[model samples]
Target: MNINGLEKTKTFSFDRSHSAKVLFKRPDKFREIEDLSKHNRTLINTGSNLSYSPLGFYKDSISVKLKKFNRIIDFNLKKKEITVESGITLSQLLNFTLLYDLWIPQLPGYPFITIGGAIASDAHGKSCALHGTIKNSIKEMTIFHIKNGWLSLSEKENKEIYNLTIGGIGLTGTIVNVTLKLEEFKNKNFITYKTKVNSVNECISEITKKSKEKDSFVYSWNMAENLKSLGKGFVFQNKINDDNVENFKFIPEEKKNKFLPFLPIWNKLTLKTANWIFYYLNNSSNHFQEDDFTSVIFPFYGKEAYFKFFGKKGFYESQLLISENTIEDFFDEFKFIYKKFNPTISLFSVKNMRGTQEFLRFEGNKICVTFDFINNKKNILFMSELDKICVKLKIIPSIIKDSRLSKKIVEQCYPEYSRFRDLINNYDKKRIYKSEISQRLEI
Candidate 1:
């Protein structure tokens, strides 16, 4: 309930809030679908605040916690599908899938996010250009609606509701569970390559070319100081291949027995300075290998303690997706804004995005630019400026990471906004399922 450097009422008289302490609130049953139909107050759906973007902002609504629903109902190996309760987190599912050599095709920056949370925002990641958004990996979903009871939706049946739920931001109804498509890997090793580039345009060209090869993952770092490596930080290009003794690095018995604490470090000034230093280093060539595909697929596979990274200030991130054709123009705009604001941005990352047919898919021949900033007044002001720029250019900003963007801008970013609004109205005429964002955006 507390955020950094700011003191505001956590609960207002017209608003409601609920917090579920872990372990104590684990329930063993599901209520009748109709029970979720109508609530007397507005609701805010939350899983984890891993979203530095806009995942958890609601007004005049009671907070709804889904952790009690975490469960794996069924899975079909032949069909490559798994049905899971909505509250299950990504880390849990990742661990579960390892037993079957299966993995979710799309993963976002953080692993603690819930399955329903990811679907709500249509989450994506570095390999999106090759695979697709999280929506593409969903086989189907079940939502508890006020008027419709429990409805199972897919692209084939109840397509509107399906599309609405995926990237729908949980406005249509409360998502109770999901059936996602799983992918099996060859258990091959991935050869990672780190490369440096000179500018954003050149980085885009490299990723576009590399992604055509079918097996590639690139993560680019944007330089905010040195002009030489201004757009180049590091690139991890991976390829599947046979793993031999020489191709692998072994962990000795002695090393395996030792335990060392991971020092928590990464602050606003430190991160910005690090980026500046890496820009000057201008050299990138690093490689590592995992013996099997499972370990590699869940790259950042661990519980996230992000507070350690940003310390007390926490961190905020804004992600924007623009058409491939606008790559140069977008960078040009960024360069101008970077010089004008000179805000303390800890890091900048870029990834290539492939198109998706989901109604709310943040896709196209787009390139995703994500910026991480410390939570502070100056940083928030800079984000407001960036939001204004994105709106002016008509670029669709990713709402998952940005916490400061106004709802009006959010409405402008998605073309299917009105349709989603209509769907929400059909189920919650009294606006029982409302959030600060929904009201501001008029959804």
Candidate 2:
């Protein structure tokens, strides 16, 4: 079926090479779990379709869109918990919760991402050092399996399946509903502070200090335009407002007139110019400021201009989590690779993270670095080389952000890879739930 007048077959990524047949299904479409379970064809669940990778794309499989499942089943103010359908977007959740002075602690940069997708990837936020991944906020979830029917998994009940599903990438089953723990807030404003760092080493040092200080939120951006000063950037620390304020504004909505349709040939030059301008503007305004928490949380949504950088070919994002012990070495090699390839990187961000104990987690207290580049053969080769370096350093790449990572790299980087495979095989014996990513990485 068509969505928003878009074709049933469509490309979901910035990369024009990948495309899939989309099937839109409402919540009531599936009268029972057995309808999907007993089907002969493979299925994959999708929501918002914001994934940078091919996790939601499958050429031979039917994709189940969860947009119609969006709803708020219940909210318990006393417990500060909300039960929402999996298709509900984070933006919707925030808007609803804000009215009650409640908040979801872990939110990604994009508000359009769905709660189910967030939980599937175990997506983290700038406040990860304090709250960990989205899995930390999930109280429980209801998943539909082909063989098991409907299962309610939680930390206390069906704990193994719950942990596996957190970062399972929707391979185990379809996430239908979720109960999330929320934080109570007096106001929606945030007290933000920014500090400039001269180098990658200094950035790491500053992030470590901020983590120790237990900052509510911490993240850094690399504003350098060239290899000579690749890590010269700013560190941001923010805290939730403690007192209620009059006339507190939510984050500003996006203006369509602010963006121009992207031209493929000009993408590289446009991004370079944009990055330089962004660096200049941010560097000049390195000062403390107070703003709405929504502003700080969803910065990317405010500007649609950055989307033009991908052009028609789209982009690939590599997010690596390097252990604190090997961070210096990783950065040294990273610089070498960046200088050697000089890929058309549109964005670079770094965040301090205390790794989770989950089986698929990027273990150890580490620094997470993300690089966004235009999709091309040369850039793909460079990313492959970077993957090799990560493997050598024992650092793990975020599978959710990766599209081209091979099974060998995954096996080498994640020690629990075999265990994960075994669990999926045992649980999804029919292999009914599938995706391009799961098929590629043999998840």
- Against the true structure, candidate 2 has what lDDT? 0.77
lDDT of 1 by residue, 230-295 (tens): 676665566665463232222111112123333336654676576666656545323444333434
lDDT agreement with native, every candidate: 0.64, 0.77
List CA RMSD, all candidates.
Answer: 6.5, 2.9
Structural RMSD, model 1? 6.5
Worst lDDT 10-window in candidate 2: 250-259
How far in Å is the alpha carbon of 198 misplaced in model 1?
A: 2.1
TM-score of each: 0.81, 0.91
Name every residue pair that clashes in candidate 2.
Answer: 14-313, 14-314, 15-314
Model 1: lDDT equals: 0.64
